[model samples]
Target: MSATREDVGGTPLPPGWAQPAHQPDAFEISTTTFEQRATETMARPFARRAIANATDHAAALTTARFVGIDHDALRDKARQIRAHAIANLPDYLDQWIDAAEAHGTIVHYAADESEARRIVAQICRDEAVTRVVKSKSMASEEVSLNSALEAIGIDIYETDLGEFVVQAMGDRPGHVIAPILHRTKDEVHALFSTMAGRELPNEAEALTAFARDRLRHAFLTADAGISGGNFLIAETGEVLLVTNEGNGRLTTALPKIHIALVGIEKIVPRRRDLAVLLPLLTGHGTGQQITTYVTMVAGPRREQEPDGPERMHVVLLDAGRSALLGGEFEEALHCIRCGACQNVCPVYRQVGGHAYGWVYGGPIGAVLTPLFRGQVEGGELAHATTLCGACDDVCPVKIPLHDLLLGLRRRRDEEGCVPRSEQLAFALWGQVWSRPLLYRASTAVARGSLRVIARDGVLSAKAPLLRRWTAGRDLVVGRRRS
Candidate 1:
C-alpha cells in the first residue's frame, strides 16, 4: 500500500505514491502467510524468467572472472576481513567517528530505525529541503525514510533507474541489486507512456534516454542527496559507494548537502581492505572487476576539492545489529550484500525476491529479516529457504547462511511462532525415527498410505494440508528391496 498523507504525517504525499503491482505486506509478513506470497509470486512468469536470466548471466560472468584463479581463496580472505571487522566493530566505529570528525564531517548514531528516520528528517527540515534526490540504499529502505521525509512535504526522487522505475510504479523492489528485476522492458515502457501521454517505444535505448533526461534534471536541481555505503572505512572515515551506473557519483557530487545512511556493520578497519572487498563484491554481485563507479567520500568535500557536497552527514544505523555483535548469528553481519546468495538459491530463483516479503530478500533476507525483527514479526521468513547450502557456498563473505537460517527456524519453533500442526508433525516424525520398531512400522504404514493416493510412482495430494507440498512436485516412495 502507498503511504497516505495521514501515514506520513498530515501533509500530502508527492505524485506516484499509489500502491504498486507487487505490493507485499512489507511491515506485516503475517498478514498473508509466506506460502500465499510465494505461490502468488511463482505464478508470475515474467518475474521467474527475469530472476533466472539474471542469475544465469551473473554466474557465467563470475565463472569467466575466476578462470584458473583461486576464487575460493579470495572468498576465504574476504570472509576473514569481514569477520575481523565485525568482531571489533566498536573499536572500528570509534576510530571512524574520530577520523570523520577530524575531517569536518558530522556523524550521527541511530540506535534504531525511528531515530535514523528522525535524524534524516530533521536534517531536511533544518536545511529547509524542498526537493531531495537519492541513490539506491537498502538502509534507507529499512527505515522507510522517503515516506518520513515526504510526509513533511519533502519531495524525494530515486535517482537509480531501477529505483526510479520502482518508485514510479509505486512498488517495492524485487531484488536488492536489481530492484526492478521482476519488471520487463514492455512494462516499463507502458509505465512511461502513461506518464508522458505518448506511446513510448518499447526499447532499451529509448527507455534509457527517457529516464536519463528526466533524472538528469532531478540530479542537477535537488536540494540534498541521500546514498547508502557499500563500505565505510574506519581508518579514513570514508564512505564507499559502488554502482554500475554513474548516478551515485552524480547524486553525491551535485547536491550541496549529502547524507549517507548506512548499517553499522558496513565498517572495515583498514583502507587496504577495499582491495579485497571491492573486487569480491563486484565479482559476486555482478561479475565485474569492479562496479563502473566506486565513489569514495573521506568526509564531504575538502577545501581543495573542486566539486562535491559542502556538508556531509553519515547516519550510522544500528537497528538490531549492535545486539547481534559477539553472538552466534554475528556472522550474518559479515555480509557484503553481494547478493550472491540470492542468485544461487533455488527457492529464490523460482519464487523471486518478492516472495520473501520484506526489504531484504532471498536466503540472506530470510536470515536477517527474522534476526532483526524477532520471531513475532519475521519468523515466517525462516521457512522461505530450502536449506540447500547453495547460498552459503556462493556467499563472498562465507557467511553460513544455511546455518543462520536453521537457527532462525529453531528460534521460531522455540518461540512458539511455528504453527501447532507443524510442531506436532515434527514431534510425531521424531518419535517414529527414535524407535527402530516404530520406524519400520511407520515407514510401512506411510508407504501403504501413500499407495492409496499414489498415481504412477508418486503421491498425490490426498488432503487439503498436503496440497501445499504436492502442488509443485510429486513425492515418490522408493522401493523397499535392498
Candidate 2:
C-alpha cells in the first residue's frame, strides 16, 4: 500500500473501495455524513425525550434569569471586554505570569497537547503520584490527559459525578455540563453495579451517594489534583473554577499539588471583569444566578495559610488558539464554555453532542473544531448547524456562531475540501439560476420529473436527487414557481 493508503483511518472500507489520495479517510468521511447519524439519534425515543426536557428546562430558566435585566447590553459589554482582552492578550499574559510567579504559583506554557500532557506526567512523576483526582476540564479532554497519565501508571479519578459516570462506562462525554444525559438510569445502574460488584438500585440519590463515597477517598488520598480554569484573572493572578458540584472545590483544595490546565483565552485583563462574566456564565449555563461552588486559587498555599496545595501549577495551553488571534473567528476565544449555544441549538437537541465527533460540540464546536483540527478533519462539522442564529442569541459573550460557521464553509470550499461532485452541483445550480431561460427550462424539467415520481399527489423518495428531501415526508410539487 502507498503511504496515503496506509494512512487511511480505522473505519473498515467496503470491498473494492478506492479513495483519492487527497480525499479524507473513512473516519473523516463518516463525520461529514452527520445527517445519517442525526437520523439515527432522532429515532431514539429516550434520546429525544431526555434532550427535549433538558433544553426546555435550561431555556426556560435562562430566560427567567434575564427578566428585568438588559441582557443585550450585558452581551455588548461582554463583547467589548473580550475584544479588548483578545487584542491585548500578550501583555495580559505576561502580567499574569509575573503576578502568578510573585504569588508563588508555578506557571508553564504548553505549545501543544503533547507538551501539556508531558507537563502533567512530569508533575505526577515528581510527586510520586499514584492517584490523582480531576475536576471537569475540557482542556484535559482535548489533550487526552487521563490516558497519558494512565500509561505511566498514575491512577486518575474523575471527581465530577457526570465525568465519573462517563469515565466508568468507558465513554466520551455526550454534553459539556451533562455528560451522561443520554444515558438511562438503568444503564448507569448496570455500570455502577459492575464496579461495586453487586446489583445497585436504579435511583438518582442512590447513584450519587455511591459516586460520592468513591470520590471522597480519591480527593483526600490523591497526590495531586488536575483541573481546568474557568477564568484566569491577570491582575490578581487567580484561577477561577465555577461548578455546580463540590468536587471542584475539594479537588483543588485538598491535594498536595494542584495542576490547572487552562487555555490562554481564559485570561481576562482584570479581577473586576469576573463580576460581569460570572452571572452570565452561570445564568446562561445552568439557569442559575450563581453556581453551587465558585472557587479561586491565587497560588499555592503559603506558610501562613492553613489548607491548600503545597505547589500550584497552571499549564497555559495554546493548542492552536494563538493562530486564531486577529482572524475571522477570533471571537470564538471569547467563549466561556457556558454551553448556551448547544442548549439552544435545534440540531444539537436532535443529534446530541457526540455527532460532532470532538471535545467541543454545537455551534462552538462547528467553528472551533474545524479551525483547531484543520479544515480537512473538522470541516464537516460546519454543516451540522441549521444557521438558525439561536446560538447567537443565547451566547453571553455574543460570539457570532452562525457567521463563523458560514466562514468555515467558505474556507472548506476555498481549500477544495468540499467534494468535487458538490462543487460541480453548486456550479451548475448557479449557472441555471443566473439565466432566466435556463432557470425556467430546469424548473419545467423538475416539474415533469416530479410528476413522474408523484403518486397520490406526493413525490416518491425513489426520485434521483430528491431522496434526502423526500425520505421522511411527502412533498407536493407546486404548479407555480415564484
| Counted clashes in each candidate structure | 0, 0
lDDT of 2 at 6: 16
Question: What is candidate 2's lDDT per residue for 116-169, written digit by digit as tens?
Answer: 999989988887787788999999988888878877876677888988877766
Candidate 1 lDDT at 401 equals 90
TM-score list, all predictions: 0.91, 0.88
The segments of candidate 2 whose C-alpha lies over 4 angstroms from its true place after superposition are: 1-40, 437-482
lDDT score at residue 387, model 1, on the 0-100 scale:
93
Local distance difference test, candidate 2: 0.82
lDDT of 1 at 10: 25
lDDT of 1 by residue, 235-297 (tens): 998899988879888878998899999999999988898888889899888899989999888
Q: Note the Cα lDDT for every prediction shown.
A: 0.83, 0.82
User: Residue 349 in model 2: shift from native, Å?
Assistant: 1.8
Off-target runs (Cα >4 Å) in candidate 1 are 1-30, 435-441, 444-465, 474-482
User: Candidate 1 — what's its lDDT?
Assistant: 0.83
If candidate 2 were superposed on the true structure by all CA atoms, what would the RMSD be? 8.3
Best by lDDT: 1
